[model samples]
Target: MLAILREITIPCFFTSYLIVLVLELLRLLGRIPGRGLAVIVMMTVGLFTHVCYVLLRATSIEGVEASMLATWLDWSLLLALALAISFFVFYLMRPDTIVSFFFLPAVLALIAFAVSVRDLPPFTRTEAVEVWRNVHAVSMAGGSAAVLVGFLAGVMYLVQSWRLKRHRAGSALRLPTLETLGRMNRRCLVISTVAVGLGLLSGVVMNLNRWGYVSWTDRGVMLSLLLLVWLLGASAVEFFYAPASRGRKAVYLTLASLGFLVLALVGVLTTPHGQAEKGAAAEPGATIESTTATTVIEETTP
Candidate 1:
């Protein structure tokens, strides 16, 4: 059992989540009589395995700073873990909510992307900025999760609206009321916008302290700004415009913001940090370590 848990990988949890999603879909189609105990059991097991894998990764490091998330891969793992835990808790509370259609596939994709890019070097942070980096990373992860929730709510709103328009009593019976979906969508939007806005501000502060300037043209920065702006604008419209079809409009805007967020994530993961010290070992004279060592030696001699 120990060995199995130790060897547990992302694919292990990914497959488990896939099965859960399939089961939920089956239940929704009325092929199953009730919210089966099987779905909840499978989801619980998957969440357990997922957590084990993350803990294994977290303890893999060996040094003073080992406790901190050292790389983008670690951050990605945390993000997926957050999403999974939230989903599982929500599933337990509302057994009939059919959100796996969006979240399960997203979890799978995140796992695939993480595995594909696992070879990238981990990000090393200086002590001066490590605290702020953690805050920014966690805030952004929260924001991304909120956006996903909003996106799912939007999708539900459209489906429910369509069923009502067609007067499809059979389908509408399975869906939440439009008001419920709208309230969820609005709440998620507000949370996402606030979290992301704070994240962006923290990033700016970190950059100013470290580099004395923020790179306005950086792809990640530009896309994140675009996402924030869209979220804020959508919130304004949803609250103030008083349009009858505001629900549909809010859903579309949330989906658009999610798209921008995906782009920003790719940009951040692909681009190496400017502070990253690559190939410095080969060019010994220019390494930060060597410079510090020399300074220490000179001070000792004097």
Candidate 2:
């Protein structure tokens, strides 16, 4: 089983999803017999292989027992997996919709980014804080996935609203109702806020366990704090400010959240946010090892 999983490389699932995307595009041009079955088959294959790849990477070896979320490569791949699963669910729910056209691209982009950072060193974590780190990683990834869903819903809301105003409601291109999209966006915002808030709190616990103090100057920390603040503020507005709870205002809030998420991701990738030198353990007195790894940011945090 491990050998089979080892052979399931990025290209395996990537190609499957790429073919699925192409098939989806072709569906737009005209009808193809068995197209729906073909899409389901391809998506299933892609998802299976993607899950296998993630599971393989997430296994703990003798010395490298830290959670897979410690490295950018694995973290990005996990994020992509979450998005792919969401797309698969959405596709199953509305096979004729053009949502996959937008979703598959983001999945592919995340895979590409994972490939780009595949060589970076994984962060080290002690056994004591492993569970907490996993919580941090999973919550953060879930929050990110929710943000992406919200952004997509927001885009769909805008497009659907435009179509309605322009009398294109009866067009072949089908989408969810504006009200449905708004509800989805609102739900996603709430989910993202809660998940990200949990992630941030877990991160703080992990930091305090490992270093005894949190480095507020860390770029990743600052950006994450900023993101959490924005999410909280957006959620408050959507809850307290009745006018912003639905429609275009709600959509705009989600769009802005995506922007903040992008900036935070850029900071994480450009700096050693969750990563540390090879062989370093999360000991209270253990100092962080400086690395020659080239990144967009050269400054290191202790």
User: In model 2, where do residues sit more than 4 Å from their true spots?
Assistant: 1-125, 281-302
How many residue pairs of model 1 clash at the backbone?
A: 0
Error of 1 at 252 (Å): 1.8
lDDT of 2 at 160: 94
Candidate lDDT scores, in order, read 0.75, 0.82
| TM-score for each of the candidates | 0.52, 0.53
lDDT of 1 at 200: 89
Model 1 TM-score, 2 decimals: 0.52
**Model 2 agreement with the true structure over 200-234: per-residue lDDT tens digits:** 97787677545556788989889989999999999
Clashing pairs in 2: none
Q: Which stretches of candidate 1 lie over 4 Å from their true place?
A: 1-128, 171-173, 273-293
